[model samples]
Target: MTPPVPPARLLVVDDDKGILPVIERVARALGFDVQFRDNGREAIDGLEELDPDVALVDLQMPGLNGLDVLRAMRDADPDCRVILMTGNPTIDTAVQAVQGGALDYLEKPFDFDRLRRLLAGVRDGIERREALLQADASVAQRVEFHGMIGRSPEMQQVFDAITRYAPHVRTVLVTGETGTGKELVAKALHAVGRRHARRFLTVNCSAVVETLFESELFGHVRGAFTGASDTKVGVFEHADGGTLFLDEVGELPLTLQPKLLRAVENGEVQRVGSLDTRKVDVSVIAATNRDLKADAGAGRFRSDLYYRLSIIEIHLPPLRDRREDIPYLTAAFVREFAARVGRPITGVTTAAELLLQRAPWPGNVRELRNVVERACILSDGRMLTDRDLASAMAISGQAAASAPPMLPFDEADDADPNLLSTVQRDQIQRVLLDTGGNKAKAARVLGVSRRSLYRWIERLHLEA
Candidate 1:
């Protein structure tokens, strides 16, 4: 047999020549191919040639420092893992490095055991990413999961639900506000799962005419209707053995609900003219902005149909609610559409991000994606500027202006307060003014809501 494959490669870079040998010994002993560098800059150049599975970088270097190397490594290969070794390690610096995507940082004279563990963790992470990439390549090599991006905690929950439910060949209902990417989610559900091998169909229920609803959905025999001269197969028949996504299902006419329900329940449909009932296996995925439960309660929707369609429910939170994930999502969308539209756009600028953070994306992710796409297509270079977002932000600002001031009032404070209290009140006013005075939005930015937000605003007695 041929020689066994070598262990995974690990790159170790530092200025100290002696430390290089120690790390090499440790890494080789641990079954990793070790590469060394005398300085951070050289390490990075070597990184380009070596493509090491993981990198161990020192914090202190003459020309290019450890932190600098970490930054460069991340900029070059976002997926690369950089473990920082620092002689003068501080909590703030350590936190900054990790936040900047450095895998882990090791203090000078760090326990070799701890270093090894961190390296192993990085290796595992890289392996998992590679596996996912391989799977994607095997499928369609596209990065987007529907219109959604980011593997954050909240989005991951949505993705896991999509994966588990998409392959079942059952009806699904996705409920979310406008611009929340309900359609993208439906497409993603179709892209994978059991329906991957078959046709995936879509129709916007709200856009269809009630008069043609039956004909459009169930098809028609030749010369069966006023517009029909030839035979036509309904979406159900076309999507047989595949997925049929009904977006905005809540907007479908009340009259059409029964027929839609019948087809879903029995997997049988009758053409507008043909007397015979044809059976078709069509997996349905529905989405709506309206509250289906309330609609059912109001007798607008069939309760039985609601139960049948809601076997899998995906509720997408508004963008503002998941503000923490905005940066990642924005970056992803920028990269994607920029590449697709053949533009030079690289990413959202910091100031643009500040505007994004403050503005209310009432339209949710759909609006954000549109804004980014526009910016990407129009931008001259890699960076999306604040100017690109000016129009949207102006509209958001006008909306903010019209909305009632979200000020917190204290019942007791309204009656009376001391001079010291007034000073506290002034400070709160300043904070509110700095944060645009939208209490609910400000509260999120300040990490306080419910009781504390109003108290501070009320205490300050400011128009926040």
Candidate 2:
């Protein structure tokens, strides 16, 4: 059973009493939950409380104007779309309103058709945003691939490669930075490959003991070594007629590389302390974070082994290079962590979203997941705010330096009356300078709205 969609909330602010009735009528007809404000000052004051999806304001009003209210709304809730309507409309005023983030401007003696069309468009946009948010909620579990969630062009290319190569490839080499999900690709290959019904085994080359490396890769006979209490079958034999995933393959010892190459090239393995070679039909998928080509050239890795593995190689792009995917990734992580913690966290605040965008994710997707999990654990409400995420990031010791600097406490300490203000002012100034006077970007860096940024600029007497 599908749930009924909620109506879009609309706020109408106008000094003219005549305009109020018409707005109420049109808004109600459009299925909007409408609120009316007689003055711009009241609308500005109630902006945060109303949290409207769309706001319609009069151009000129007493005490405050529509432009001022629009600016205030933009700061308090950047998601809201605003339209300015006026009796004395001009081309210059329309330009100013649009430039100030007004979605559209209207003249007096309103055209009902135009107004209906505009309202319908706004409603459609609202529906789309709501749909995206709902989709994000299920993204953690409904990922297209094997726990892999991405829609970027780079990831699309990877998906295409996986689709094309999975069905036919035997020995595939997956290369990417740590946490770029190389193992996932290996699983994908096996899942889609002809050996889907057979066993898929994983062996971490870096995790295995140096002495036990040979025994781990190939079966060992009784009394093979010091720990030979019983004859044991290795991962290769266990995954016969299936796929064997070698994680961190670059970490495999140079001396053992020749044996691994022989096993991969020929479907055969020689057990330790035995001259007999047993044939096993197994597909090999090797993953590494290191540049095996460079290692092979430098005489650290076997060139023949490298060449064999390079026959089918898939490289994953770093998270930094796919910044556009961060929003989707963040949403998925938020949903996953929220469910894990039994919280009702829906999403992040706009300012927090901006902070995430500005962050330098050196650790890739794994790091982002950890950060989101920490934030979810710390969050107490439906939405994760900038402060909650900041606290979580502070624990990592990375956000404190890379993310926007938090301002001083509201209360001034008696020991340093002006010190706090001085530091706060300096931080704000530095961020503004770094953004080259881009108030929107600077506000995002400082985790504040544009209106709040304006207030700080005025209060601190700082120039753009």
Candidate 3:
């Protein structure tokens, strides 16, 4: 059942006590829960407690004028709509009011009709935004595809491609930026494919050492290398008649490309330091954040291997390009984290949703999920306000700001450390410890890629 929308809050700060009654009547008629302050000082003091959706302040006050109240209100709640009123109006003060983030400036002598219209407009806007948020919450539940929630046309296309190719494709490539859920898409393909009942193995190509690439993909005979103490069955053999998801495949060593290509092409793999070739029927799903085509053009990757892996390519769009999906994603994340934490957080307020929609989600869905998770943890009420989301985003921004410059993990130790680097190191260590040395869980909590977390661990010289 849908809950009733709360009344829009309106705060009126005017020195004249006589005008308070007039404003209250009009505001209450517009369905506003109204509060009155005799001066700006009192308004500013109570601003945090009232947390009004709209504020009407008189320009002329003894101390801390309307402009002062507006600034305080903005600092307290940026989403609040402010309207300034004054009897002795000037062009300069009017300009200052507008520039100070006033929704509108009104001349006094009480144009009751104009005031009524303004109040009604604010009420209608608040109600409309509330309605949209409710609609988004409903749509979020309906538009889920597998574990991913998106209604954007780009995501819809990707879903269609997965449905069409999963049943038959042998080799597929999923491409997108980090945190765009390439791995999820790979899992979705495997789940719907003919090999659904078989083992679905995943190998993070970047995480594996270059020397172990061949042995990891194709089994190694005992005594093949210094650490080849036993004849180990590789992923290719273990996942025979199943799916092998190679994440960050662009990070695979150039020397091993031919062997990988052969495994994809002829379903054949040769164990390291062995003469015989083993035929294994394994479906490969390769995912990478880098453009393999561009890398091939630059001679950084083999063209033949790239072509073999990209028989059916699926590209996932970034979150910024799909802004319309932000609300739905937020709703889903809120519900998920709230349930996981056993909180009663119904959803984010309309203002909070607006803030999320405007955010530049560089980390894409993962970053959004992290923020929502953090907000859910911080919130103690049924609805998450803008303040909750803002605090979470601020923490994220601080961590991002303290991050060291991007360098290869192998060379990270050589870079000089600074104060910001120290802060980042401490934060990573704390999260790692909190997650009990689980790099994957820490990465999700920190809103970073596992590869990035690994690099930070190396760069910061942490025990994890």
- lDDT against the true structure, each candidate: 0.71, 0.79, 0.81
Ranking by TM-score: 2, 3, 1
- lDDT tens readout by residue for model 3, 1-464: 44344477899889988888888999999889998889888888776456678999999899898898888887656668899999999999999999999999999888999999998998888767665554544553324678887656788788889889999999999999989989999999999889999989999999998999899999899999998999988999999999999999999999999999999999999888799999999999999999899999999999999998987899999987886667667777888899999988877775676677677778999999999999999999997888898899887772322222221111112222321122345567878889777665676677754444555676456898
Q: Which candidate is the best by TM-score?
A: 2
The CA-based lDDT of model 3 is what? 0.81
lDDT tens per residue, model 2, 27-56: 889899998898988887666456577998
Number of the predicted model whose lDDT against the real structure is largest:
3
lDDT of 3 at 314: 95
Pairs that clash in candidate 3: none
Model 1: lDDT equals 0.71
* Residue 249 local lDDT, model 3: 94
Candidate order by lDDT, decreasing, is 3, 2, 1
Q: What is the lDDT of residue 416 in candidate 1?
A: 20
